[model samples]
Target: MHVTAADGWRLPAGPVRRWTLRPAAVGEPVVLSVNQRNHLAGVVAGQPSVWLAADLPAGSVPGIEAPTDLLDGLLARHAALRTAVAPGDGTGAVLHAPDGLVWVEDDVVRAGTSSDATSAVRDLLDRACHPLAPGPPVAAALVGAGAAARFVLAGDHLVLDAWSVALLASELGTPRALPAAPAFPALAARWAAEPALPPDDARLHAWLAFLDGLDQALPTFPLDLGTAPGERFPQRTLVVPFLDAATVAALDDLGRPEGASAYAAVLLALGRAVRAQRDEPAATALPLLVPVGTRRTEEERATVGWCTTTVPLVVAATDDLRATGERLRAALALGSVPLDQVLGSLPRPLRRTRADVFMVSWIDYRRLPTVPAGTNHVSNVTEADDVQLWLSRTDAGVAVRARIPDHPPAVAVVTALLERWVAEVALLLR
Candidate 1:
């Protein structure tokens, strides 16, 4: 296989070194968690590239000379990295722990001449972004030499989450016999048997009503992608560093007094931008998919798996920025119920397809305790069908990345939307 870089450089895909991780002792079969099941459903629904990748921080890199040896040691210590998925016997999917789990442990091909680190990392990440192989569902590679060296880890979202990536990076070399964390199987069983409390019921009902009120077909970005009906849409990403440090601080200060959050502000700006772009009526409600995490406890946070689901947030085009922010905060507060429970409560027709909704997800890299120093940036690449906007805080300031279908019209629509969002954000900050 050959991968062409964005700069028109072609990289020859070399043979990958593979390994099988064997469990020290055979254990009982583990059941798939609700989060894992959700990921499987996403894959079936056409969102195939549900993988996460991150650059290993300089401080976190192992002192060992060989990248393969370092990764082997890291995998041997982390049980979660050794996990895979298997078909259940007349039951649902089960978490498979093979005696020997196969994996793409390492891949390295020396360049004829010394290559710049940036180009090398870009090519390596392009390859890493591909779908995970059958068993183990994770792969790692090290490319370049000396100052230009880069370490990459790619994993199936079914078995890994953002928190898991940070944990793995932080604990790479320093192995310790910490107390065993609750595995996904145990969490799945607990969630299955647990009844929804009164609060959970309230959240579920609110979500159902929200979904019922939404149009059968929600408003989409105005773009004629020229795609055939029922054809799979290819996705393209556009990233822009919209906010500087001073502006971010100003926005934070402005929202602090009103109990508004950065996330609420972003959503409000997005809603306004979409309204302006489409010239929709003031009464029109724009539905935005917002992801909520299920790992509330310390123990749950330590465990690694897909523990998130997207809920609907309807933004009214008529509302003022403050009102919109307040309403969004309230809606999110009421949407604390687990996604699986919410789905089970909804009727078949009312349940929304995961891929059809527009999404706005925020990640604050500064808040992650396990994130190592010199961590430059982080981004998620998924082949989702809908327009997805990812907002994250990097060392520079606020960064926004939009993923839409890979067509000229779609790109133009998203580009205009992003520009309008930036302008709206500026107006709000003033």
Candidate 2:
């Protein structure tokens, strides 16, 4: 799902109500997947959650007066909701049973002006969405009244990853009808049972070399963010509508001739944009940590968990779309492995780098059911020192959002870099 900061979305005038997940039985000890452990590696002091806001279809808001059995059953079905993980270096996880597990009471929230309603919902989310909170880590709030309304689900990233949110849109359509899938704990246990790629495996070697080629550090914004190491600043969300439907179609048609794809075209554009901002040698490879999904079966895809991995992609500073496409294919072929495991293989210094170096998340909405036009995935506001670019392609077109350091210079440079990125994409029309 395409996610931006909460600022891009807010519900219209309406009464607010909340649905909280109430745990019933004592949780059972479970193993945390490497990815889960990595996400929960260090302690986060404040309210930590990933917010998802959906603009419902004509009948999407199943009920309004009180929590519906549909929703309750839906919550029980997904194991991710009941899985609890605490911050630590060890395998600390507990999966609460989902039978009579959650309770969503009709708690009325004060409604003010339209803006005020959004603020109240956000405040509720901040108060309720701790991963280690009572019951499940998720909480929901319904806004507006009538057949068509909006809802937001905020929870820890441990439960909802990028793919989970996308699948969530479909699940909301018919939660009970979703494919039967393994519990998140089962997935974690299965992963633990698999033999990890040996230290000398090709995939691990390629990943390690990727870090080494980049000055022995995770990839940084090619330009200066004007911050010292470990120094974080407020982040600015710059949403750039980079491509329209016809334009994206044109990108596809144009690249199709050389066995290239829109993804490679974007990489070509991004590589060009980065080189435009500063003088870099042609031999330089722009290192990016691209997320690789781990769901190999339909059962896994239908399940909710952090079933994703990351690999370092080195996009060369060249305009050849086919070559770029080949590199991307090769990078992904490095296979899916917990990003933490890969980082653990690095030198001590690189191991201690920011959790995100430079991450680029790309999702195409065609894979999901047709969601309402205004549907958006929202992220919690946290101090960000590293730049992460989210690229989402929907029926409307392609959109780019960047979480950049909030300093003026960083903002200006990122703004200009993205502007050039848009221009570069346009040059594809030629």
Candidate 3:
């Protein structure tokens, strides 16, 4: 395979060399993700590229090869999956950084039952999904054996985000070239070199000042779901789906009066649910953190990283749901705030407090490729949970993903909470 840079820049063409990061210390609580506003979006800073290793039971699935050809196709199809910087992309080299490419690493492990296979897969995913690490960006990985054989892909957030995970799943097992997408290095150079990017505005400056006062990085914030210690990582997810087209139209109509969006309504509902789960005063304002995609330009959409900002809605217990929804609307209106600056403004202590940061994030990815005609896709499992909530938009309508800190009571939990939240929000709007 060969690559010719569109802009006439010559790139290295050679066989790949690999290295391993030996464990230096024990009990290192990996920073799996950063606050929405932080530069590291759900990844650790400085380490460009994350390694996603999937442990599969030793067996042969139809149409799959041991050293998969699909893997090669994926890398060749997406340049971001193959290239890496020699020194890394950070500070000065940020402009030339690639979206970090993707590579597959393989290892074999002892056989286990279906349950073990599933658990092992989840464990590797959680362990490898570190908060956005800085670079030399390379979304490649080294795979190896553990409880089972694993395949890992390490890449930087500078080129991708969480939603891309679904895409990874889609590409895996069945690698094929996608229509040409934007290149990461080009976008990075443009962003870094552009003179017109608005300087830190007044609001941005004030927020930064606030963050300067509190730089105390504290213990990792645990999502308290009130589960037995062992149950902390419940192999359950709340699955939710969107409302019908008619219902979605109704929501758009209702939103016209106060400029509320289907997203705002979802936030209001999630805030209410979180309040109901806790003993806090109803009047206490619960801030719902909504993630706004900053990939606004045609070219920007294709590039990734922590390009999302948090829009906070302070929901009052006494406020009617509509009123809360309006507040969300107003907050979303002022969506130009830079997320990095916002995180920088938070007193380091408060910023790291999981308890203080309980909120909701809105994700919309309907415009990208759709799930293939007959693929099995799952939705949110429940309507409510204890703490953090996620509302995502799809061509169908709105969906949800809520994270509860053991305070709320429920049974038979699963992974489609966001889907259900989207359904009801559309219902209320309509």
Candidate 4:
């Protein structure tokens, strides 16, 4: 399976050199579940952050060698990686096995030069980040030469989530013979057949009423960008290393005494920062969309796909951090309902505007099993129109990454917002 780029760089042919992966059974087309449908809808609606990527350290890359073994093993074991979505009679999507499972390419300019590694990897990643066609969604490649070489994997978010990345990272070197978990198609079938549980009426009513009070629009961070119609917004990211290892531990200790998790504390601090920066009325409610994982059991965690939903977390402008934390926890607990169900319950107009709200996501990277020694995991960024505040718990403590619209005003304002967010986090921990 030696694949050579047009420029003559050879890719380490994977183990499946002679045969394509054939589905065991392929009679009826698998219907896309409600969750899968929502994901597709997001893509159709122009949400740009639809890819996940990871970079793993490579040992001495002896000119011709690549991580073909690792990539081959992963595709062979993970059925979800081989799945694809195709239109089904204009009704919905039908899931099926793609003709190919993985796409590999080579980017090393020459055999021994490391200077082109970073740019080459970036170019590979950018190409892999685009939306998947009606074929395999995963892409991989080896970049750089010798000691500086690294392997990178990129997949469509529709089929691979952050958990899948972590799972693959854990199993990279040591292939474990774990029990076979339900594949994505099986899970989708089960989810589609499951009866919808009634949402909490009281909570739903309160949420709708809250939105009504806001005139069905949430306040965005003040920016001075000129009003233009249909201009494509560029994306900018601001990374802030605001917490050290000791500070993270202390913050955890401070929150633990109050029955608050680190995430809740961070949310509270973000709420406070928003209030301070916007100088909103004390009664103003800032709506935040937080992603809650749908994988509840161990088996579900082992399964791959976009297993998450964004739920509204409305934070009131107040001084009571404890109360805010309690509210956030409760909201997250009640956010287990599928996103389609949530949108279905809302009015048509509100449903259209729901995704316009800001987003806050926290990833505790420490929970991921350590990869092989010398192999560091690099995070990938997805471009989105909404103001997104991502908090990562890394070895250095808490790292804040803000993804914002690339308009001049939005960039400037978001930079200040993140600065204020760091200060608020410091104040809370102190």
Candidate 5:
């Protein structure tokens, strides 16, 4: 949220320098998370990476000759960078990486203007930060110098989750003030060793029942997205204003009596919008892929790594708002078990058949650490078959962001869907 590079900051006029890093000593290889393995399963050569970019305020890095000075400390602080996933046929071990900016002068290119430099740095990240490959899973670059410096930190989902990306963005904007926590490689090893439940376990049985209910297919868009089977289209995003703070409070208040939350209310509204349009009068539940935060303790909260797992939430619709909310409350406990374990317990073919997953994730920044205003998340051009919805509640209010395949029909239909969702939510207030 600091003044941008354009506001009185200077872009480096000299030849822009570069630094590449390797691990000083190797750590033990760890198994990739199920999310990581699946995300890497899609990577191909020349794939534009999924990434995050930020603009650090003026004088954020005083006495620093280059952004590398800041990058070096960041590299040390977050160990997820040091674990590189070897690209093969979908499955591989995360090999230990050589330590920080130890290598100098990989190459330097000269750019005359800020725009040119920005493009060059972006390309650099796209090359270095590829996922499911035999190279660094993380890379960072900076444009401009001194007060006007901005950075682009790119990595695959394997090593960097949304929470990790947000924390990294905040750190780049401010100096490295947080204390060091446990390294990710060690934590990952311990996590990999955790015992999985047998097939007869109650949690496994509940998940199995849900999966059996899903049959073999995942939830598709209620309306056509104008794409062919397995066809990939460039991603597009739309951010639409949702409920205001007062409305959110009212919804929560209404649900509180039923031991339900505003989240459950919104889920019910989402289900109604989706099913009502599809004209499935008998449909009573909607299953959403939910990203559950896996950070086990407060100390691990600030540590930068992929501390999240994806689980399914079957949002059931009922006559009483109380019943729907209570159902959601009980379902959240299922996330405490790791998703890989759930998938591992299932038949292998079932996992391979599902693609272009339909997921809806909700994150409330108001509950976590404070972030500077104007600090936004950035992503890259990629192909997708389904629309992914992220509902984020900030101090400004609740807003739902949708990433859909960029097409005229999609824009039109999705606009209608969100509008309906808003209207459905408004009914709960009445």
Candidate 6:
């Protein structure tokens, strides 16, 4: 339980329950970091809690004293929020278990203020929803100063898959619905009890076997540390934009030539595009990481929490965009086929596969809820903070947290690339 100050406010001794959902296949092969994995699990299984920190402005009156009671009530309503791991059980192979409970300390956005009182209120309310350390299942941070609150959530890849974080964000600031969330134990039981169809089960089993077949051939992605001159160099970020409707349509059309979805086509196209950008030779191996949603039955879809596995699609860079797209589509068509069986097949390697970025990932959020379509539409709503990039690429997206120093004005470059990418796709579809 280490504590520190950020901006101006100090974090109080508060507890937050953060949930870590894992795929059943990874349950038996624990190989991730101990402090981040079991340490979190122990925290969740025993006492799920977190500390929050913030910096307050002097002379600015606190509009709402921190909602201590509301937060407590929230804890009471989400049982998973109250659980923690049994001691000595949070390390080594055990980390690969389906989920982990982390006790995070407040260490998100440091300095920043809102512009107006109303904005500040909204900002505070949002912060109240996130706990410090192991932060929220996703990434979260505050921007600007008092009265003009803007926040960011950088959800952990393992804990939040696309729409999951958005659902959690929808609950910020309000009193949590009562009766605590259903326990993970019950959820696990339901998963174990689900009836398995023989054919589908066999398909899944085969998928797992296939993944095992590629243990030695899958390409690994090196982390994108950025092209900086030296350590202690300024931080820079690439602003990536998402595809437009037309681009999506074009991708769909591209796939239709071979019976694949736009997403799968885009994945393949992007691989080719990236390879082209680097002037890589044909046959360059690019491993594409795609998160598979394995909540089989419709009933399981609404069950919140992470239930996804990262499956890598290794393809050789080719000169033909259509050829590359078809290859990707074909791979995905069969790649994500039997998710459970895939997990069960190569228990140990799957853990490594997740951390291996050797390629970027796709996170789709088209089906996410959107504030009921027309609830209190504030027409002139404006944010009183620096403009930020909101890049969307199919199912996955990432925001440029901050501009890196000593770079080629990356913000503009990245944003331009994103816009072009979306426009190109949209135009092609049209």
For model 5, residues 330-420, the per-residue Cα lDDT tens digits are 6666776766777666664364232467778778877655544555555554666687887887766688878787788887878888998
Instruction: Count clashing residue pairs in model 2.
Output: 1
TM-score against truth, every candidate: 0.80, 0.91, 0.56, 0.80, 0.84, 0.51
lDDT score, candidate 1: 0.58
Give a tens-digit lDDT track for model 1, residues 1-430. Answer: 0111123222223322223232343345566666666566655555554556445533357553565566555555445565654433222443444335434433344455433433454544444443233345566655444444445565666667666666666655344544555575576667667767564466677777776666333334333444444544656777677777777787778878777777677777777777787743443567767776667788776676666666677877666657777777766675456666665565665434334457777767666545555433343444545577767775567787677767677777788778988898898877
lDDT (CA) per prediction: 0.58, 0.71, 0.40, 0.58, 0.65, 0.36
Residue-level lDDT for 37 in candidate 4: 68
Weakest lDDT window of 10 consecutive positions for candidate 2: 43-52
Instruction: Give the total clashing residue pairs for model 1.
Output: 0
Candidate 4: residue 76 Cα off by (Å)? 2.9
Which digits, one per residue and each the tens of the lDDT, describe model 3 over residues 37-58?
1334222343222332221221
- Model 4: residues with Cα > 4 Å off, grouped in runs: 1-28, 33-35, 42-49, 60-66, 87-134, 199-210, 213-231, 279-284, 351-356, 372-384
In terms of TM-score, which candidate is stronger, 3 or 4? 4
Candidate 1 segments whose C-alpha is farther than 4 A from its true place:
1-27, 42-47, 57-60, 66-78, 87-108, 111-134, 173-180, 197-200, 215-229, 281-284, 348-354, 373-384
Better by lDDT, candidate 5 or 2: 2
Worst 10 residues of 1 by lDDT: 1-10
